[model samples]
Target chain A: MQRYKCIVAYDGTGFAGYQVQPGKRTVQLEIEQALSKIHKGDSVRIAASGRTDAGVHARGQVVHFDSKLQIPGERFKKALNAMLPRDISILDASPVDMDFHARFTSVRKEYRYRISLSEERDPFLRDYAYHYPYPLNLEAMKEAAQYLKGTHDFTSFCSAKTEVVDKVRTVEEIIFNTSDDELVIQFIGNGFLYNMVRIMTGTLLEVGSGKKAPAEMETILAARDRIQAGKTAPGHGLYLWKVDYA
Target chain B: MQRYKCIVAYDGTGFAGYQVQPGKRTVQLEIEQALSKIHKGDSVRIAASGRTDAGVHARGQVVHFDSKLQIPGERFKKALNAMLPRDISILDASPVDMDFHARFTSVRKEYRYRISLSEERDPFLRDYAYHYPYPLNLEAMKEAAQYLKGTHDFTSFCSAKTEVVDKVRTVEEIIFNTSDDELVIQFIGNGFLYNMVRIMTGTLLEVGSGKKAPAEMETILAARDRIQAGKTAPGHGLYLWKVDYA
Candidate 1:
């Protein structure tokens, strides 16, 4: 058996997210079906670094699978691309050690959220950006984002539906950037919980809008209650940017 | 009556183009509907810098309309934006001279054609760009584009379905640029013929693929037949960048 690793990109629209659901379309099921076709009369299963929620996009997602076929590393990418849907693309394919699992090997992950801070909605960017007509105070949001960095129990920012037993996670960096008409929030961490990034974006928005203070982050963190955080931002504006292995 | 000139942007995916079509959605129809709603019982008609064909997008399309409503120019923009659909936007609105007409007063028009040269289709950009996987010779295409500049009889390049009596037109500038995995073809002209931009893009792609030479432009021009030109590029890739008046 040969283990292969692949980097993938996908527009998460028209999908029920990355996991396999009984009645809905999924990125994993589509890729597996394509792999089955390429492998000729045999079924193939693959695992990804993480399970992104519905409507969330990805620019640098990684996955791995073991196949009995002895296809060259280069041919693997080309064949998969030909069989995959237009929305999903395999950027690269390479042979990996048998023990290198996509989920187990991933050590760090990065996500970026986009907010359009303009009064008028942009027609071209309607689907990809979250539109907020109200002006935001960037200084306050930046100060609040700084408090989100470093290791902490992010229970208050995670969704109530999360099944993870432990809520402790290390957020290595949180950066805020602004353009003429848009605001970008970037977060890098060892891992994330269900809807954690969206929740963080909403909380930061409240800070920027003067509804919350930057120092309130500590109190929210200690509460360990989902209701202590702000509402979750829309999934469309979130992008899975990168996955790192140490 | 006050004449207002407005700069507009739209995603042409849902419209039958810029012009009003019977029983079909058009950018003009959407804007006019919004104006009527905001003006309250006043049915305002709009005239645009150019009547873009079906499926052609715009970034800086100029339009003018007259209304008797007593409101500030900036407020009109805000009102129209509130009433317009998600696919259309009024970027700016201002009072203009009574003699101004968006079509007749326009002095220059610029357009861009986007072609994706990647091996895999971009599902996110599928509706916004044309996908061509073959390797293109950008230098050769650029050289061929230069020959299209200056005044020339574009009868060969113009679509035969056109209703205009004149086929002669002057091209002020034509440029072809290639980035990491995309090709952009820009054109500036006094006016364009029906289906002209798409035809030029198609002919240039032929040149880039080595199917045609730079000198063939002169021959194609001399042929005075649309069939002699290359295939027409897809409509989704073309965008009306701007209209200039002096």
Candidate 2:
């Protein structure tokens, strides 16, 4: 058997999530079904770098699987894409070493959140961005993001339902970019807990809107409680941008 | 009665076209229905800068209508947007002079066509762009576009079913831009004949793909025969980008 690595992109609008549920539609389920067709009725399971919540898009999601089929990487990509639905696409596929695990070997992950600052809703971008009509204080948001750039116990920023014991994670960088009608925030981290990025985005938005002070980030992190953080941002605006393996 | 001028944007995925057609769901029909609801069952008719073909999107489409309501401009915008569907949006609305018209008074119109040059299809932009996986010669396309600019009888580039006798139109400019995976073509002109832009785009694609020579544009124009022009491109990739009047 040969291990194959693939980079995938998906709209995520109609998907339940990346993981497979009993009867729900998911990215993993769709990919597995396509692979099963290629394997001629035999089931094929794949492992992804991480799980994304329902309605969360991905531009560079990474996954891996082992297969006995001897097909060229390009042919595998073409065959999988031809069978997959329009919303899900395999951007690339390649054979990898047996030791290369998609989830365990990942060193970094990047995520982006898009917020539309236009007072009027844009018809085309309705599904891709979170529309916030109120004005934002960019300076305050930038200052708050500084506090979130380093390693910390991100328990306050993670979902309370998370079963993971180790809440400590290293955030390499947090970049905030603004355009005429939208604000984009990118988060790069060694590892992220469940709902960590969305909670952090929500907290930054509160700071940007002047509802909370920039210094409050320190207090939120120190509390180590989910109640100390702001509300979780909607899933639709989040994107699993890229995954790095080294 | 006051004349209201508004700039609109729409997804155009579910719309038949910009014009009103019986038993067909069109952009004009939706706007008129919304206006009727606002005017207490009194149907209101609007005149747009021009009609867009079926499945063609619009970002800055201009329209004008006569209304007896005494609401403020901002209120009118908010009211209309509140009633419009998710696929359509009223970006701006204001009272215009009695003599102003949406169609005849317009001096310039801009249209854009998007082509995806990526070998793999992009799921997110499926409805917004044309997937042309073939390689294109940008320089060749640019050379051909120059011959298309300026005043000319566009009869060969227009639909034969059109009833308009005056086919002479001035194309101000044709801008070709390329990104990593897509090519965008913008056409700024005083006016366009029915299906003229699509036919021109198709002809340019032919030139870019080395299927036709650039010098053939002059011969096609001199012919004044619709059959001499290249095939019309699909409508979904076309956008009524903007309508300008001074």
Candidate 3:
């Protein structure tokens, strides 16, 4: 049996998320269905680098699946892209060892959330960006992003639906960049819990809006409660940027 | 009564273009409805700088409307933005002379058409940009754009649905820029008829792909027939970048 690893990108606007659900469209289901056709007469299931929320997009989402066919990795990528919808594409595919799991083998994941901070709404970027008409304090937002870096128990930044027991995660980098009327906050972490990135964005937005201070992140982390954090930013702005395997 | 001229931007994904149509959602109707509420019993109608085709987006669309409300122009901008749907935004509103008509007083309209040349699809940009996997000859495309500049009878480029009696229009400038993995064509013209911009983009694309030569644009323009030009490019890739009145 041949094990293949593929990098996928999908626009999650019309999808119910990455995971399969009854009576709902999903990125995983569509990919598996395409794989099943290529594998022929065999069921193919893939393990994703991470499951993103509905209306959340991905740029370099990695997935791995073992197949019995001896198809070349390049050809597999082409075949999958051909079968999938225009909103999804297989960027690259490669042969991997049986032990190489897409999720387990990942050492880090990068996510970016975009906020359009302009007085006017950008009609062209409506679906891809969160429109915030109020002017944001870029300096305050940048300062807040720095405080979120390093190892911390991010219980306050996670949603209530997160099933993970451990809340401790290492945030290697948190960068805030404000360009032209848009603010992009990028987070690189070992792993993220359900809605962690979105919640963090909300927390920083509060700081930018002068409702909170940069030091509040420490107290929020100590609270170990979801209610302590601000509301999660909308799913439209969140993007799974990349997955790194070590 | 004060007449206000505003620059607007919108993502055309959910709108039925800029015109008002019964039983269909449109950008013009949405703004009109929002303004009507602020006017309090007084009907508010807006005239647009250009008529964008369905699914065509805008970054700097201009519009003008009259209102009897005592709200300042800046306050009106803020009020309209607060009440408008997430897809549309009134960038700025300034009191202009009642005679400054959006369509009639316009000097030039500028548009930018973006096509992603990367083979891998971007999930986040699916609805906002056009993706073409095939390689394009940028040099050839630029050469064709030059020939398209200046005044000409663009009957071949105009759509069949165009109702204008006069087909002659001045092409002030046509510039092609290829940066990273995207190809962007910018067009500044005195006026365009129907799908003129999309047709020009398609013809240039054909030239870039070696399907047609750059010199053929002259022959096609001289033909003065719709069939002579290339197919109309998809609406998703086109954007009304700006309109210049002065």
Candidate 4:
């Protein structure tokens, strides 16, 4: 069997999640069904770099699958796109070395959260961004982000539902870009625990809104408890921006 | 009673149209219902600058109405917004002179059509932009726009259903701005007949795609027949960007 790597993008509004459930519609199920149709009824399973929750969109999600089909990369992309729904797109596909495992080989991941800071909620952006609708101290948020960077056992930043026991992860970068009335926060990390990005955003927003001080971040991280963090931001504002592989 | 003018923005995907059609959900119907709710079940009518087709969005649609309520404009704005759905937004509201009219007193209107130029259709922009996958000669489109940007009887560039007999209208400007795989075509004109902007865009696209010559626009304009122009572009990609009043 030949291994193929594909970059996928999806608007997750109508999806249950990235992973397949028995009856729920998901990104994985859609892709696998399309692949099965192409292979004439043979079951084809795909491994994604990670799963994103329902309503969390993706711009550059990476996945790998094994196939015996002889179609070239570009032709395969077109074929998959034709079979998939409008909300999902196969950005690119290529045959890869069998050594490339989508999950284990991923070197880093980038996630982006967008907030609409306008006083009035915009109708067009209601679904794509979190409506903050409050004053924010950018300097305070940046100060708190400094405490979030580097290696840490981010137990406070993840959800109680997270199954992974090893919570230590290296968050390499935390970027904040404010443009027009929208604020885009980008996080780059070797790996993130479930709901880590959303939790971090919620905590940073609390700091920015003066509900918490920048120094509180240090204590929150050291607490090593989920209760120490702020509320989890909504899934709709978050995007799986990119997944990088070595 | 005080005459008030309001600026509105809406995502038109869910609306039937801007006008009140019995048994159909329209933007005007929603606004009127909201006003009635605020007025203790008293029906209130409003006049809009113009009507937009179903799935045609608006950014600065202007409307005017007379109200007997003693509330301030800003407070009324807040009240209406609280009553309105998430798909429609009241951007601003202020008292206007009784002589002012939304449709008749408008000096000009600006409509914008966005076209996605990328070879691959992006899922995020599918509802907001018209995806034209073929290569386009922008220079040719601009050259054709020159012929379209003058006072002329736009019979060929409007829907056959247009009611106005005097089709003469002044198109003051035709501007093109291309950036990041999207092209925005803006038309600023004294007035537009029904489906005028969409038909003009379709005709211009034909010239850009080498299906028609730039000079052919002049002949089409002279023909004074709807069949002389290209197909009307889809309503989803059109925006009533702004309305100006003297």
- Top TM-score prediction, candidate number: 4
The residue ranges of model 4 lying beyond 4 angstroms of the native Cα positions read: none
Interface Cα RMSD in Å, per prediction: 1.8, 0.8, 1.9, 1.0
Query: Sorted by DockQ, highest first, which candidate order results?
Result: 2, 4, 3, 1
Residue-wise C-alpha lDDT for candidate 1, range B1-246, written one tens digit per residue: 989999998999888999888999999989998988887767889999988877779989999999887678789888888889988988889998889989999889999999998876677777788999998888888888887888888988988999998888889988777788998889999989999999999999999899999889888998899999999999999999999988
Better of 3 and 4 by lDDT: 4
lDDT tens readout by residue for model 4, B1-246: 989999999999899999999999999999999999998999999999999999999999999999997778899899999999999999999998899999999999999999998877688887788989888999999999999998999999989987799999999999999998889999999999999999999999999999999999999999999999999999989999999988
lDDT accuracy of residue B37 in candidate 2: 94
Candidate 1 recovers what fraction of true contacts? 0.74
Off by over 4 Å in 1: A39-43, B39-43
Candidate 3 regions exceeding 4 Å error are: A39-42, A135-147
* Higher-DockQ candidate of 1 and 2: 2
- lDDT of the candidates, in the order given: 0.89, 0.94, 0.88, 0.95
Model 3's alpha-carbon lDDT is: 0.88
- DockQ (0 to 1) for model 4: 0.75
TM-score of chain A taken by itself, candidate 2: 0.99
Give candidate 1's error at residue A235 in angstroms: 1.0
For model 3, how does the per-residue alpha-carbon lDDT over A1-246 read when each residue is reduced to its tens digit? 888999888888889999999999999999999988887747898999989889999888999998888888898898888899878989999998888999998999999999988766676567678988786787887787777899989888888887889989999998887798888888999999889999999988888899998888778888899998888999999999999988
Better of 1 and 4 by TM-score: 4
